[model samples]
Target: MSDAQYTLPKTNSGPWNTRPFHRQWLMRQANNLFDFFEAASLNPKGGFFELDDAGKPLDGANSTRQIHGTTRMVHCAAIGSLIGRPGSGEILDHGMQYIWNQHRDTRRGGYVWSLDNGGVKDGSKQAYGHAFVLLAASSAKLVGHPLADQMLADVTEVINTRFWDASRGAVKDEYTSDWSKLLPYRGQNANMHMTEALMAAFEATGNKDYLTKAEAIAKLIIAEHAASLGYRVAEHFDENWVLDKNYLGNEMFRPAGTTPGHWLEWARLLIQLWVLGEKRLHWLTDAARHLFRAAIDLGWDKVHGGFFYTLDWDNKPVMREKLWWPLAEGIGAASFLTSYDRDDYFQIWYRKLWDFADNHMIDHARGGWLSELKEDLTPTSRLFVGKPDIYHALQACLIPLYPANGSLTKGIIEADHTAKIAH
Candidate 1:
């Protein structure tokens, strides 16, 4: 490795603070990843392709175009475009067209989970994918995509009418393609993403309804569901919003037991809610801090330097494999907390997180982060192959550089204008 490649960031690099240096470094890293993903992942027709370690398409022509992946690509592309990155608008438009043409269920009224060359590989309507659709549209709208407003409107209608549970203040997990029957399970995973999507929608449209819904879901997860379970956020739930800790609905997405990565994710999202709520909600910040601590204490493996994939109800490591998303979320949560409060604890954690990611997760040879690792930090593809999407890792690098008091889209917009003024 080059001397610059694996060097750990020091907390005391300067007399005052090394945060500014960290910010500049993070911007370069985020931009490099933005360019890398745009170049390697976009399919010719539109949308993105999941690539293997060698940067080759995993599925060739018959690759399954996932709604979540497509939306995440658009989200990253929108950020890149807003930040004045060259060639970003092309990828943004490509993702937008792919979603509108291929993913959206024209007659059924919701996005399908996946599409292959033969079309409609998994036609089941998933709230997770739909939430990403909302997020993508919201982001595209911010960057001034031509169809973003209409797309946001359509997605909002679908989510409200089909996935939302009016009484429970949470979103349902899944539905049949025709929207005839709700699925048997409910999930905080989907609700968490829904909260993220709603926040982005609120930013894009100034829709108070979106903000209100996002806050409601945040409370449901952090205040109620997580509080009841000692702040270890439950992933699966029953139809009535009761926790189902033993449920393994989907091996990849809704695995059984609590996911520490999600707890950290909620921490960051709660911080966002606290900020956009005009700091009126004091509990949101408190809940965010609590969630961060809970994840660190319960999920981090002392023997191993990374967070475990899943923890059982008693806090034992359920799946010992370390995944990349948790560390990304950890960096975000710690950076956000440190930015808001100037807490040295979060600063230390943030530096440690970057160090861990630099030493283990980053693919020095290829350019994207490796997605999964063994407990010993060796590259492993048990759950994920190559780099599926850049959303989480890119945000991990960029969100830390911006002020913690607004949505990421808002921060990027402000930074973009500031850069233009500087030029």
Candidate 2:
């Protein structure tokens, strides 16, 4: 396909696409999440508490504080403050402080995977968690958190030196805290998130280098790996970045076969990367649309309205349960397409996905969205314990309210600037 072919035609939008009520609705959804997580997430000792189904703090010391949760909490709060939510600064500051004080490996170099009451719960360093560290730090920096500068610089150094595999145009998978015994495994999930973090870093710092790495990773994964595989988004790979079809390391994190959700995620991330790159890469938008269509084709439950958690090599559902994050990602992808292409196809999906989330996944009375649902679209807890996170759902609401070309941080800042000009 020629580069010009990627100039997808824009058109008149429908109510779902251009309605004023939807923007207000999106803001209300975002604020609901901000209020929910902010009220219950903080742990006095260091990071966030593990909340149960009712939003009550679950017993910690018994479990672990994964780096993703802590970092995402900071990210969620940073975006909150960007939207002018009061008390969000404290949440962002507290989470950033906890990340440095607890998750950072002072003994070694990189951040650890998880933490307990005393210290290091699981000391292994993972690209996935570190990617979020970069994301959170970039977000905190965007909001002017006091610790943002040091945290951002520290994580940037760790990612560049440790995880980044310059040869493959992507990052490596995992390592021990001592920085020895590197895991031979490679996966796109971490790298997918790294693309997101890199974009956030670019938006926060105006660093073209971050965009360079982001474009490399997006090309390697979406334009190359995913394109070759019918845009299915292979989850696991060997050290050489070769697909591991039989690799099912963990049911939750590394389930067997392709994760449809990541397809939606990469779709949006690819669009953002392309936008940030000034649309020089025509293939990024094309691949993003392909990935979005593939997610709906292979991941969506036909009999149901939500997306499946995983699918086998045969394209049949492996983990048939519906997940909240996929719906969140689907909303994100659809909304971006709605904004970018302005076509009713994507605009329709945007409303449909959000409608499905509202009907099934969102627990209106309980505060945050339900984390899991049965294949039939009823709430289920077989996979998750409680209302674990607000990042995905929160972003689902906020992304559509902002520009398609930037992170929520940039979106917030730009919107505020525009408002000031209007005033």
lDDT of each: 0.85, 0.86
lDDT of model 2, residue 332: 90
Error of 1 at 11 (Å): 8.8
What tens-digit string does per-residue lDDT give for candidate 1 at 281-373?
899888888888888888987877899999999899989898989999999898778767644567667777889998998887778888899
Highest lDDT against the true fold, candidate: 2
CA error at residue 333 for candidate 1, angstroms = 0.7
Candidate 2's C-alpha lDDT?
Answer: 0.86
- Backbone clashes, each candidate: 0, 0
Residue 22 in candidate 2, Cα distance off native in Å: 1.7
> How much is the lDDT of residue 208 in candidate 2?
90
**lDDT score for residue 8 of model 1:** 34
> TM-score of each candidate?
0.94, 0.95
Native-referenced Cα lDDT, model 1: 0.85
Off by over 4 Å in 2: 1-17, 60-63
- Superposed by TM-score, candidate 1 places the C-alpha of residue 50 at a distance from the truth, in angstroms, of 0.3
